[model samples]
Target: MAAGLEARGRTATQVRLRRRFLRFVRVRPGERVLEVGCGTGVVVRDLVGLVGRRGEVVGVDASRLMLGKARTLCRESARRTRLTLRVADGARLPFAAGRFDAALAITVILHVIDPMLVVREMARVTRPGGRVGLQDQDFGVVAVTHPERELTDRILHGVAAHIYPEPHSGRRLPGLLRAAGLEGVRLQTDVFQDTTLEPWTKTFLERRGERAVRFGIVDAATARRWLDGFTHLVAQGAFVLTINYYGAVGTKSR
Candidate 1:
């Protein structure tokens, strides 16, 4: 989590997610872009390359710590690509209306206090006919290979969603765009399925189960067993997992 979350680097899974997100947005060269809650600026670095030299991309986040990391990761290219890193709240972006040709909140909505206000702000800050995009996972759709299917279900739908606010954000994105008065809303999904039990995909169970124990959703002993089950399943070469992420984009009314 630390490596991918703070390093402005993509995990193998996130690399695939990024491709799907960019496909939905279809940004053009020389277009000004805004990415709210830009994390550590992994996507911002991509946007910098997408918009090329003439254009600029602003990456803003509510966390100064994240912005600081983003600034450091993007420093080499920021000067050439005209990237800007700032601390700003998504619900109230610090930019004038219609200031950008495109705006996006990639994997950021679920963590926001008000996804609705953030989307509205995204729409408001983009120019007429400009683009708006969002990408998030529906943790509700998680599946893991385990003998206790019922426990797995609880861990995914109840525990994971409990720990992460708006874990089902991916499912709500299309309606959100429409509610914001954006037109021609489009959506695409990227499914993450793995057999190797990568930490990013598999250890999520341990983390969720541990928190579930703390929250009393599951007992500490049960959480331990679940984590232990992961190792056993992997050793037997029977481990498999899947999660779905949705990418959505729309055009602001001209």
Candidate 2:
């Protein structure tokens, strides 16, 4: 998981999209920030740069292993910027209320059992007028160029349904922030497009394929066939994959 997080963070598209969302949240130097579910400190590293030397960025994750990896990955950056990592739950952040200028969770709401609780905790830790940002991919609109459309739908849709309570979580961010009593909610939509089947993209597909088989959505043979379809398309220079990411930000009410 650490390797995957690092790989995704290193991807050009991901880096651009992440930093764009941070800017949308209006992160500034010398402000304290908190990131929930900071897997491998990918976004935390970016936040360190955005907050500058005078600012502090605190990261929390439920998994100690991921936090350990984050510390290792973010070691050098911590020297120049105030950075902290802790193993904590999103629904019960270990900080006092109004402790941060901004709080964000990227691609994390979808996996959590209770997103609202987490959002509320994030809001509690953020000062009134500070921003709460949430970003996630809406799997409902993901498009891929594959000859086996039916098979693709079965694997992708079935796996997502089995894994997440809300597969279309990205589109719900604005509503979520509002439900959490945040004001002036705004949304930003971004696309991750891959035409050449980059390594990260391949791993993404492979992981999906693995999940499909484990979930009994497709047999092992069928899963292999489905993945091979992508390779064939890539060889023919016809491969295309696009996923939409939705970023929503809102302010805490005073």
Query: What are the lDDT scores of the predictions, listed in order?
Result: 0.84, 0.94
For residues 113-166, what per-residue lDDT tens digits would candidate 2 score against the true structure?
899999999999999999999999998988999999999988888888998877
What TM-scores do the predictions have? 0.93, 0.98
lDDT of 1 by residue, 1-254 (tens): 43556322445766767866886798888999999988788888889888999998999999898888888888987877778899999999999999999999888888866788999999999999999999887888877888788887776677766666788888999999999999999999888777877756555666788788877888888878877887898899999887888889999998
Best by TM-score: 2
How far is each candidate from the true structure, as Cα RMSD in Å? 1.8, 0.9
Q: Which portions of model 1 miss their true places by more than 4 Å?
A: 1-9
* Model 1 lDDT on a 0 to 1 scale: 0.84
Looking at model 1, residue 124 earns an lDDT score of 96
Residue pairs with colliding backbones in model 2 are none
